[model samples]
Target: MQYLPLFVKLTDKAVLIVGGGSVALRKAGTLLSAGARLTVVAPDFATEFLQWQQQGKAELIQGYFQPALLDGKLLVIAATDNDLVNAQVYDAASARNMLVNTVDDQPKCGFIFPSIIDRSPIVIAISSFGTAPVLARRLREKLEALLPQHLGPLAELVGRFRDNVKAKITGFAARRQFWETVFNSDVVRDVQANRLPQAEQKLTALLAEPQSLAGEVYIVGTGPGDPELLTLKALQLMQQADVVVYDYLVSPEIMELVRRDAERLCVGKKAGAHSVAQQDTNQLLIDLALSGKKVCRLKGGDPFIFGRGGEEIQALLPHNIAFQVVPGVTAAAGCAAYAGIPLTHRDYAQSVQFVTGHCRPDGSEPDWHSMSRTNQTLVIYMGLMKAAHIQQQLISAGRSSAVPVAIIENGTRREQRIITGTLSQLADLVTQHDVSSPALLVIGEVVSLQQDLHWFGQRAQAAVFAQPLTHIA
Candidate 1:
């Protein structure tokens, strides 16, 4: 590590800044916010600095660089453009054993200001040791969006009750567990909703009871291949989980958002491939929660859709395990939007239906007659294996062989591929493109709209409809 990160309190502390330009003004604003008693030394001053001096926020000294200026200062910043003057300030501060920072000059800096995300009582400081400041700032921007805005107020509220909690809760473990419950409960919800009085009341009520550990399951739907599609509640529960039970369909980018230290157990299922049996996955969730572990049953797309989430949650019912279901952007919706093929357009199609091509254990087939209805969009999930069967069945059920169709592979992701053709050529299109699982099959007149409305994926493949079925292998 090039530098030891620290957060120092500068409230009412003496600090010196040796410049009057925009960069110096920027540093001055931050110091003032920290309540630092500042003295600035420069031959000339900016308008803002003169105004700040008049307001008694800082003391302005009109003079050249001097070693004596470092006297009795806690920290110093040399924001001057002149290299010689910046070096002079650094030497003077170094001789006096004071912390000094030379803006934009790493080797000369005894301390470097970091890109900070301030949530008042909560603050995050990020630095790259001046090697990649821009990268560090960009990272800070991303974090700023991810972190909730009410964190500071929440922290302050908890801080006020620290003494009371410490007095009531004997062991450190007990207090930590208590706080975790508070964070996971309606207390946090109330706080986030800005209902402070209700939040405080709930916190007090919670503290009045004995601290105990109870585990629950969060059935989160990590939307179709896009991490950004995850709901706020889903992300919150994911981070709070002690263990995450995921599947093959869930995107890796979505998995990365789960709690870093949380144990991950994959029960990934695909066509003809099961990493772990569905029954065993149910038992695993029950076992973990029974042992007082918070389990997150994460699934790709909407759990209630074609994801078979109902069967998993039903198993938990007998055990009386608590669970939450967070819905996600299902594959049909995600893929259609990304591909710019409206599932239900007023002119193209009035109705839309979602179905899975995987045959049932009982061998009963979906009503092909209804699914083959005209002017209706039909979206098939996991249809790659049965593409030929679907094409044959739809045509046999009075659906037109010339009906437009599209196979969207890895929909909504950067590697997404869209293959468009007629229903007669659905099987051929899949074979030619070597389409894989987790692909959505759109069959209807709406698929024809891809020619004019296709927005994402490789546009070079946009001319897919022009290719004749016989042209493909």
Candidate 2:
């Protein structure tokens, strides 16, 4: 490591800035904001520096930086324009064993300033160890958007209650677990929303029941691909998960959002491969929960639909394990939204139905007569293999040949592709477009509206064509 990163408390401490130009002025401003007693020594001062000196806001000595200026100072900045003068100041501070930073000279500095995001009590500093300042700043900008502005105040509130929480929870493990719950509770959410009174009340209520053991499991739905689409409750469950059992379809991006130290077990079932059988997976969940672990059964989409959540819950019920479910944007909903196809509309359709394309192990086709009615939208999940049979059955069941259909492949992903055609032509369209598995097939008049409602596809296409290979590389 080029430097050990640390944030020091400089309130009321002595700090010396050995320049009066913009660089030195910026450093002085940061130190002042931290409540440091700052003294600036230079041959000349900027207009702003002079005004600060006149207003008695800062102490300024109008002279060249000398070794004696390092006396009794906790921190020093060698920010002079002249390289030789800055080097001299760095050497002087080193001799005095004081922390020093020389502007634009990492090799000669005892400390380096990081690109910081100041949320006060919740400050985040990004550093590249003087290798790439611009990259660090860019990363900071990205983080600024992800983190809420009120996080600092929320952190302060948590800090104020730390003592009380510690006193209430005696056991070391129990205390750590209680704080984990608080971190994911509604209290933190309210604090982030700037509702201090509600947050405090919730915390007080939690403290009142310090010894209660109300363990529960949450079947959280992590939406298709994008992690941002995860519901608030799903995010909270992930943060509080003692052990997370996830599936293969759950994207790596969504898995990345889980607590860093939480145990993650892959129980994903590939078509031809199985890491863990369904029965064993169910047993593992029961064992973990019985051991008092707060387990999160994380699935790709709405767990109730095709995810075998019922079987898992059945196992838990026999053990009397408390559990709750958090619904997610199902594949049909996510694909329909991203493909710009409304599942239900006044003009296009009135009712919508979701059916699996895969038939039962008996190898019998689904009854087509019930599904062939008009004014209804049909979303077939995992239907790519049976598209031809489905079309033949629908046509035999009295559905019109001109009924529009759309196949959305890898919906919501960067590689998402949409193919539009009539039911009769869907089998052919899938062949022409080379659409793959994990696709959604939408059949009805609603598919016709997709031509005008298509927005996400156009953007995805534009992104693909606008960038050259070298740009992405």
Candidate 3:
């Protein structure tokens, strides 16, 4: 380690700042948050510093920098714009054997502010020894996303029980195991689910009778292709999993977020084909959890909506396995938004329906009467193979043949393709462009808005009636 990292308790400690500009103000805010008693000496000061002085949060010394100002101070921060003044403050602090930080001047800093992830009582500080501060900040952001919001509260709850646990459980090794069991119990799960009172009650009960290690299943949705759209809860669970059972629809980018050493099993299902049968997938999840593994069943889009999540969860019910459902942005909403075509608009559509064009294994057709309703947008998932049948049925059921349509391929991703045409050209558009599975068919007047509202990916290639389908760059 280039720098030995330590978090010092600054509550009620005397600290001196040698500037009063915006830079000083920023440092002052962090110090005040840590309950530091601050004295700032500067010729001019920001309004916030003056307010802090009046509020008794800090003391103001209106003068130029001097070595005497560092007297009796535990820490000193030189935040002035002038390099010479900062060096002078650093020298004075060094002479007195006090810690000093010259803002933005790393070489003169005896101490440095690290990027902090404050799930307080569980704070994480990351420093790059001033070599790569921006990279350090980005890493902090990534950690922030992965850590659950309830971690702070969870830590506080555990801290409250520390004395009781120590008194009840004997020995260091035994206590460590006890705490590990507590973390894996329903107590932590309840806390993560935002049920604090329930979590507390469960924790108390678990203290009386610690249970054996059990497995859990997390049915997580890895929103349409973009890893950034994943929920924090999903990310947390993904990192905690012992194994991940994912689908082809779950983007490769999302799979990368899973725990590094986690066992991966791809039970990927696609349109008109099953890489692994639904029954086999459900049985696999049950078997994995029965083995006491933390299994993550990762899917693309909302699992309940056409992702067969209901079937899988129902199968778990008989086995009495514990599971959680973390919904992702269903492809319809995610795709439409990226294409800049509102699923519903006052002038175009009053409501929207998400329909799947993939027929059941028995080859039974969907209810065309309801799907043919006008003035509402229809977002069809897995409709590429049946585009002609879908278009003919809707048109026969009194829907407009000329309604605008947009075929969104790989929505929300960099290589997304948007092909615009009329309903009459829906199947022709798919065939001509060779649109594949995983594409969404958006049919309604709202599709026309892509002309004016299209924003994501390359410029959409519009298909005129007789011309070859324009190549989507």
Candidate with the greatest TM-score versus the true structure:
1
Q: Which 10 consecutive residues of model 1 have the lowest summed lDDT?
A: 464-473
- Clashing residue pairs in all predictions, respectively, total 0, 0, 0
lDDT at residue 140 of model 3 (Cα atoms):
99
Predicted candidate 2 versus true structure: per-residue lDDT over 1-473, tens digit per residue: 77888988988888899999999988888888888888999998889888888877789999998888888899999999999998898888888788899988888878888888988798888998877888998999999999888788877887888898778877654666777778779998898787999998998887787365445677888876656679999998898877899988787888889988889999967534568999999999988888777889998778898778888999899889999898888988887877778899998799998898877879877878878889999889878877898999999998888999988876665566777889999788877777766678999999888878665545544454442111000
Cα lDDT of model 3 by residue, 128-239, tens digit? 8887889999999999999988899999999999999889877654565477678988988898898999999988987898534477899998888878779999998898
Better of 2 and 3 by lDDT: 3
Displacement of the residue 277 alpha carbon in candidate 2, Å: 2.7
The whole-model C-alpha lDDT of candidate 3 against the native structure comes to 0.86
Ranking of models by TM-score: 1, 2, 3
Comparing 1 and 2 on lDDT, the stronger one: 1
Between candidates 1 and 3, name the one with more favorable lDDT: 1
Candidate 2 C-alpha error for residue 370, in Å: 1.9
lDDT digits (tens) for residues 1-473 of candidate 1: 99999999999999999998888999999999999999999989899999998999999999877888888899999999999999999998998888999999999888999999999899999999998999999999999999999998899999999999999987654576688878989988888999999999999999999766677898988878877778999999998888999998898888889888889999979877987988899899999988777899999899999887899899999999999999999999988877878999999899999999999889999899999999999999999999999999999999999999988887777567778889999998988888888789999998887777654333423343322121111
lDDT ranking, best first:
1, 3, 2
lDDT of each: 0.88, 0.82, 0.86
How far out, in Å, is residue 264 in model 1?
Answer: 3.0
